[model samples]
Target: MATRPPSLPTQMKAQFLDAFNTSYALRSVLLPTLTSAHDILIKVDAASYCHTDAVLGAGKMPPNPPSFPHVGCHEFAGTVVSIPPNFSSPSSFKVGDRVGVPGRAFHPCGACFECSSPEGPDADPPGYSVYCPHSKNNGISTDGGFREYAVVDSRQVAPIPEGMSAVDTAVLMCAGVTIYAALKRCGLIPGQRVGIMGCGGGLGHLGVQFAVAMGFKVTGVDNADAPLKLARSVARGATIVDAREQEASEVAVQVGQEDGKKDRGDMGLDAVIILPESQRAFDYGVGLLRNHGKCIVVSFPEQGFHLSSRDLVFRDISVMGSLVGSNKTLREMLEFATKHNVRASVRTLPLSKLNELVVEYHKGEGGKLVIDMALPDEQS
Candidate 1:
């Protein structure tokens, strides 16, 4: 077991929003108190921002999100400082263990079909504790990991494996597990071909890496040089396409040509994962699939997809919505990441610079911005 700090703070700084479309503010708030028998208080070490944070902060999360005094960031990693006694926890973690709290941060109702299914303990049923009829998103619906210390449900966190840092694991929390779930839903096997739209962004990049690691021939699609370059670096032997230079339909034609089967318009990708929120990306992704191929819908667009009914019926394309991922898949992805040495290309900034970082993030800056909570005195 790791040693606990000699002292714990009563008050901690947190970045939060007072209302929708408001700026994030850093304020000294009382440290969260424990409530549930399985609740654990953690000293946050790292956290990362996501596009969903922007949507949630705008009061846009569907099915009615709660009013403000909302915290930012859903993906975080920290050290366990306190745990409830007699909890009979599922996780084997104790105080001082490094762990991560991801987006699916609530215990699902065990009575649901998804929970009782034979898919094992990690499968997420339709009525997941968070999202849809249940709106239990961590940062969106509750105070998240923008503070120095946070109170988290024990079931919502998992122990960090050996040879992985908190920041590296933090990248996997939301984006990694999400892509892994998307791939799992598609059911692609080795030698299969997959196209990842927005392959340069956080999720897209990780998607390419995971797909390649799983032995899929990957094609990364994105227009930006920053993401495209990063995608190329991560997805060796994977094809990179520019959306600006060609349409989705055009890319489909090109992919068919790869097999010298341009004469056969029926040839297309085995599966395509849409990672960008752009409808065009979704449309392009649909064009890349072969007959009966799966199109995994993983991105969240403000405006929903405008899919073609004719193509859906005739082309025999199937669409699957992959939310975060089952705990089982998460563990698998983390193990894969650890084995393959896959890591999110990240740019670290002090948590104090969160307000500024949010602005820069909107400017389309490079790399994922991780809030490094190491104080000045704590830094080397």
Candidate 2:
């Protein structure tokens, strides 16, 4: 049996963006209602801040941008408040269950080649459906988790593993699954060398930990000393390189040579997951790969990258892009994180600070911030 909310509010407070590049304003709005049998209502507990939210709020998401007066947040966790009488959810989900609504917020057709294939040529790549034309991005196409309550698809919500804090689960919903899918698609084997570009970021840190968990010889490359230190602390025996001090290419070459001398005798890094959006980072990641190695681009960069067709053909280096993790991958990632205790370092703020924090995030002055909606009212 699911626990019902004590009282559903008719109107709730939410952060709304009325125009592009404008500050979000806290406004009282009607609570969202579930219109589908499979839909569920959630009272938000915690929501993590994402750079994507900042970018989308600024109305710079390219040709198609989110509609105005939108609520912006994708990574969030909450408790189930209501389930339709005929709604069918996973057996594990019950009313009052702590749940997480992460990156893949849309429902798939379930009949498309990408959705139906399983580990075959046509199988949807891990986390691939988030980009499907039919998919509706929560924060963009619909109202998202920036408010006291949200209406979400049953398939998009996962039960947070027991004993995990909602704050931790909030960050994991996006960063954890994104990196997990990228590494999975890399097809790395134990003892193979792998490098994480931008290892100190919200997503980079998780990439390092997951690679290390998979028994890959991991190298964390980042420009910031603080993130490097944090990465090193989390991933034991992993190599940390400060990209600011030395060229990423040089670091990769040194590690590759040393790794080749080891008993496994691999020549270069098996793959490099580029976690930053800088063109230079992508270039360095390609440089780090050995012949026939792969590069997974997981970050969003506004600028275009220059790739020499000749260089690509001669080197046999494979470059691919990963958006978000799929439902299957999301489940795997959550189990893996719980089993291996992979957690992100986060700073919690009351939802009241969302506006102020948005400003600070735009200025680039914070680590991973999880908004705790449970805090006392402090709206500005």
Taking all chains together, each candidate's TM-score versus the true structure is 0.91, 0.90
Backbone clash total, candidate 2: 4
**Measured by TM-score, how close is model 2 to the native structure?**
0.90
Candidates in order have lDDT scores of 0.78, 0.76
Alpha-carbon lDDT of model 1: 0.78
Instruction: Tell me how many clashing residue pairs each candidate has.
Output: 0, 4
Q: Per-residue lDDT of 1-380 in model 2, one digit per residue for the tens?
A: 33235477788888888888887788898877767676788888998888788768766665488887888888899988887767763453557888888756466565554554545332344533544566676777677778888877777777888888888888888888888888888888898888898887788888787888899999878776677777777776788888778785577567766865442223457899988778888887777777788888887767657776754797788888877776667777888899888888777667778877676655543247778886676643
- Supply the TM-score for candidate 1: 0.91
Query: What shift in Å separates residue 86 of candidate 2 from its native position after superposition?
Result: 1.5
RMSD of each candidate relative to the true structure: 3.4, 3.5
lDDT of 2 at 163: 88
Error of 1 at 241 (Å): 0.7
Off by over 4 Å in 1: 1-6, 107-109, 112-135, 260-263, 375-380
